[model samples]
Target: MMCLKTMMVCSLRQQILPILGLLLIIECIISLKLLELRVPSHVPLGTRAELSCSWQLGEHDVLYSVKWYKDGREFFRHVPRDLEPRRKFPLPGVDVETFDTSGGNVTLSPAVLETGGRYRCEVSGERPLFPTVSDHADMLVVVLPDHGPMISGFRSRYRTGDRVQVNCTSGRSRPATQLAWYINGEPAPASAVQSAIDKKTEDLETTSMALDFVVQETDFKKNGLKIKCLATLAPVYWRSNEESALKEKAISNQLLRSSLEDVKVTRADRVLANSAEFTNSWRHVVLLLCSMPNLFLRGLVWFPFFLQEI
Candidate 1:
């Protein structure tokens, strides 16, 4: 009886070990996982954009379907078992060009401004296991400006105590560009910055800002006074325009006149000193000539010419 019991125990142990090994293998081989979800954070409007979703399936698992959703609404579907593996549903602002099954990549031609939103990619395994994995990311469709900010209402020059008022305008965009003012590389004072104005044209927007301040003597630097307008669209576009201003001509002319007066005064003083010296030398010569009688008469011939010159 003891020998029979030992054989039965060995048989049970052999069966249990094989069952446990098979379970471990099944667990290891059956899995559906999301590897990567590629969505652009910013896409330029009216341009093509490609989004990719990659996944991994274990040896025993089979890919059932891959679905893409925009703002929680299904837009694209791919099922390997179907006669047509790829299908696209109509969704506003989502223009599906092609869906590549080999790598599960989706392409959108001429993405519009309304295409900006949260996107999700979901992957599922074939029946029996039915494992699912998903991931999501946000995308923005941006309308970039064709050019930098433009400055207007600028004067040829500004002087101390003069009021300066100017406007900065940005190119048309989907979302209006934000504008800021800088004076001499520093942020303009809040008191000097006016409110931003927005203009809309057929779904595109343009923004402008005004800057007003009184010119001060301290505003001028070695490079002259600089006024800059900065335009930005968050996380994507940044541009600026700058203008330089000099002191008014009146002030410059006054300084130039003062310099000229100083030069004139110096020249007059030098001339007077030279004339006094020449007169004294001539008087000494006249006295010496008077001492010599014969030379005195000859000196008189040149005296009239010399007096005329004097």
Candidate 2:
């Protein structure tokens, strides 16, 4: 009985081993996998965008078809066995210029604002199994500004306690650009930033934001303050404009004028002191002459006697 039990266990092990080996072989034979899908995260409007899909297949498998989808709807298809290997279906904002069947690449000329969405690529193997592999990525069609942000309404100089009112405007874009203000290399406080304004013209949009704050002593760095306006169009565009304002010199000029006046007063005091000293010396000379009256009388008598002897 023990021998029979041992034989039954051996039979079961043999059956399972063969089934597992067969399954491994089948898995190795059916290898259709997507390697990579290249989709640009951001594409500028009115420019060409190229998307690529790459895959790998087993030695025995052949590629059956490759399809591209936008927002879950198929837009392009390629079948090597068909009479027309490349075909495009109509999709809004999707313009298929050329399709490369060999490399699974699709090119879109002049991408528009509506072209931004989820993109997917599907690849299938030929014949019996028809194994399919797929991948997806998101894209955004952007309208970038032609220039950097513009700053206005800023004074060339500012003083402590003076109100500063300035506006930053971004160039036209698809979605309004985001604007930010930085004072002396730091982000401005929420209270300093006013409500943002958006101006739309046709399909493009422009953004403007105002900054209003009182100049503080701490805002000055090295006798100047830096004001910067940063504009961004998410994931793609970034630009900034900066202006430097000098600290007002009114106080310093006043101090300088006071110092000059003090110097002038000191000079005048010195001149007056010299004049008083000179007057005192002249008074002493007059008193000495008055004290020498007898000498003057002797000189007069001697002058008469000397004149008679001559």
Candidate 3:
């Protein structure tokens, strides 16, 4: 009975060791396998985006499949030995053609605003006695604005004391646009700003703002006052443009001349009254001189007559 038990223990040990050795070898092979995924941290809207998948495995191991998922939904699949070597599944709001995906790489043609989300790639390898060795990588896809905002709606010239209105519009962009204003490189007054959504298309929106204020004399002090509009589509993407409004000194001067004309008229009226009074006094003096000459000649003639009478 002791010898039978020893034989049974030896058989069990022999079987278990081989199985353990195979498992260890499989683990070692899997340790050699490497799966790499590459993609940009952020993709700009209306641009092509690429998601790359590459791998390295043991010499005898075969690449079973490569799959791509977005937000946990499969969008691309590849298999070496299959009726269809590559297959593309439908993903809403993504425009991908067969030509866009090739050799474990998926390309998005004109990546859209809503296409941004979580992306994952799975790679699988087949090795003898190993239940499909697989690895996956997760990445976050953020969509950024393709371009900066566009500014418009302010005239080239402004007069002092004139009311001016300016509007700045940002180009269509994913995510709401934030707008700000600067005048002569200083923050604009909040009371002068009014913002609204200019347009909307699906998830993309265009935003604009109106800056209305009365042009002060100080605004015309500079040769050209710069009013800049900054439109921020995302924290990473922003655009700014400055519009120059030249000081219309000609207009200001005209207004100043008009104001001075009234003062000039009042001064002219006082000078005219003083001139009339002086003319009357001079006329009286002239009349006295003429009478004195006549009286002196008459007195001389009367004196001769009196002598003759005496």
Candidate 4:
């Protein structure tokens, strides 16, 4: 009886060991995998963006559901058991469309500047056996400017006492560009600048700034004064425009020479007498000669080219 009982116990142990091994094998084989989630390295504002997710599972394993999240908010879902395989939740400022729920792909048409952030994708299988698997990827949306900011209202000519008006205008920008002016390689005073929203289209806006100041004689000398307009969209984009003041010193000198020639000596004998007697006429001539340096005409040269900023 003892021998028979020992043999029965061995048989039961063998059966239990095989069943446990089979269960382990089945558990190893049933797996839901989230292989990868793809997002663009750079996505410009007001342009299209594509996001994809790849998953794998065993032949017998079923894909119960898939989900997409942005910054912790679930915006897309796919359930194979439901009649509608794909569904999208409205996320303000994010224009999202799911192209394929089974394939795990979506598109964002004309992405907004504020829509860039962390993204996550999740895949689920049979709940009690195969659990949910998830993967994450970061998408840093880049907001690119529509075009370079432009500098306008700077003329090619100006008198010394004239008020110089320079305008900086930016193309359609989402956050409304910031503009600043620099004169003679220095930032222009705030009192001399006036900014406004020049134009708008839908959600985008254009920014403009006008700088007004009196032209000074020093602005025309040597290398010619430089005026610059700077536009900023924070860390995303920085653009600028540079202009040079046009100096016509030779023309002014020619005009002075012509004036001197036109002032003919109506009374040669009287001019000689005044010259010999050290009269006020001689002092007037000396004063006129001293004032020649201050008569320079300072103007501006408009550049046709616009530079790119990254």
Candidate 5:
């Protein structure tokens, strides 16, 4: 019975030995992953670039050292040995123009194209083996285009008393649209409006704004009688375009009066219709007192009452 118990204990230890060995290796890998690096991260074309790297090993080591590298080149290495056999660090690889190890963060200014590359951070411990490493991020550059809102509608001449429409149209614009009306080069107040038309199809545009207003005589005579509909696209897609589109027209007093006269004369020229109003207006009542001098004084032709009524 004692031999059986001893055999079981030895078998259990044999199984645990391999598991413990694997656990130790996993612990080492986890410790390496815990040590991290920091970098300024991104870069853009035609602009300065910066990279950074850092690691923290709590109260135990006092964060012994930090290093910065680009591609396979070493730029800077930092280490503090004052604390107990804590950490040993090596300088960065080549390929960098300057190795700045004097500051907490490795800063690269007045940057250039070559400054844009992968940055690596390596950390070491005076007592521990295998350096902890990580890489910073890469960046991209972008280009932009001129974009804005377009003006449409309100293209033709409109006279006083005429119903007219104006629209602010656009595409590829950012923010929103700015629409206004100008009369004779002066800003006109925005009036009550109708719903904007926004249709973005292969055959249609993205957005359209409309304003409907009645015209008046003053809108035609003075101020040169010019009207303009303007659209200023928002900054996101719109570059600046400082020109006002101009449309002009003239309304003469003669034209307005002639139009009214044509309406009157045409009505006056029509043949009278057979209606009650027509009968009342065109029906002329006649009262002729028949006291002809040729007839005897006060003498009258004898006529039946019915004929007199007729």
Candidate 6:
């Protein structure tokens, strides 16, 4: 199967919030199913990686402890200590630079081929597997992307602060893929993307890897004003996802916030029981918003692309 690595351009504003009363109750009953043990299935040489892992307890029970291991050894750890539950990797031999406790994910920077190997994880609380959920997760490492990235978009020029931006987007047919953006011809920080696209093929799923940032006039004059997005492909298919071009304007804060609020969380944690499960088209919306200024000059556009978040 083919998979695409997307460097999505957006933030957690689109995160789904848990709100249902009855379904929340159901989540309470199946706490053991809270998370599945999973890894990138593939890694690359000299790059960061977030090895994702999760487990669940019945809604009636509370998460007690979670730990990750690389080849039968401890690397990352999370525990429900006292009144607070949090993720931690305090092991001396283990290494982790980016791990979001709320997301139940581990981040490793400058990941390498040597990093490729078998990985194990355990999650436990008050049950049969309360103290240990087995190896369930795997990790693989490979070569990284050859070139920086390729830039694609509808237009090349924009007035100062007009919201005209570019999308550094790419597609993949496999996992173990790495994708990201470059600013003024240099690599920039990673931005989370909230998106969704339709899947039409079975062994050829398209993953949109893109980077979106506010544009500046200097960006165009630089070396090539080349806005590029790159993705590294793995031989495995995490699952089927939709295809998309990551070159749309930014979505209005009001419209986006409204849409996000409308989304429903299907788990017990009414506030954020949902992890980053939903697929997203964060770039499309952002690209769409940035183009509004051009539309306004031509006539009138209803969406406010230039509106700043309050």
Query: Can you tell me which runs of candidate 3 are displaced by over 4 Å?
Result: 1-36, 39-47, 58-60, 90-102, 109-117, 129-168, 180-204, 208-225, 234-238, 245-310
Question: Could you give me the TM-score of model 1 versus the true structure?
Answer: 0.64
Q: Looking at model 5, which ten-residue stretch has the lowest summed lDDT?
A: 234-243
Q: Candidate 6: which stretches are off by over 4 Å?
A: 1-31, 82-94, 127-131, 145-310
User: Which residue pairs come into collision in candidate 1?
Assistant: none
Whole-structure CA lDDT of model 1:
0.87
Candidate ordering by lDDT (highest first)? 2, 1, 4, 3, 6, 5
Better model by lDDT, 2 or 4? 2
On residues 1-310, what C-alpha lDDT tens digit does candidate 6 reach at each position?
Answer: 1222232222222232333544554455444664565677765556566666666555467676776777777766676574555444454334687777643677776665557667776766654334445555566655533333345553544444444344443342323244555454566555523242323244333434444455565555432344444454545322221212233344689998777666643333554423333223566676787878687565544345445432
- Model 2, runs deviating above 4 Å: 1-30, 101-103, 250-310
Question: What is the Cα root-mean-square deviation between model 5 and the actual structure?
Answer: 18.1
State each model's C-alpha RMSD to the native. 10.9, 10.9, 10.1, 22.4, 18.1, 39.3
Report the candidate with higher TM-score, 4 versus 6. 4
Q: Which candidate, 3 or 5, has the higher lDDT? A: 3
Against the true structure, what is each candidate's TM-score?
0.64, 0.69, 0.51, 0.44, 0.36, 0.34
Q: Which ten residues in a row have the lowest lDDT in candidate 4?
A: 297-306
Candidates' lDDT values, in order? 0.87, 0.90, 0.72, 0.75, 0.50, 0.52
Better of 1 and 5 by TM-score: 1
Q: Which one is best on TM-score?
A: 2
lDDT of 4 by residue, 1-310 (tens): 9999999999999999999978865664455667788987556677777889998886667788888888889888889888987888877656575477484888876777667878888888865565677888776555456788788787776656667887888878666778888888889888888856558777677888888998778665563667898888765678998888665443578888877766765467678887878877788888887777445322112222222221
Query: Please, what are the lDDT tens digits per residue for candidate 5 over residues 1-310?
Result: 9999999999999999999978765554455433345554433223444444545443333344555556655566666654432222343222333445432355454444455556676665434534354555543221122245444555445555666566655552222344555655666556735556656454323556666777777665442355554555322223322223222455589999999999988777674444656677544432122334545332444445547889
lDDT of 5 at 136: 59
Per lDDT, the best of the predicted structures is 2
Give candidate 1 misplaced runs (Cα > 4 Å): 1-31, 56-60, 248-310
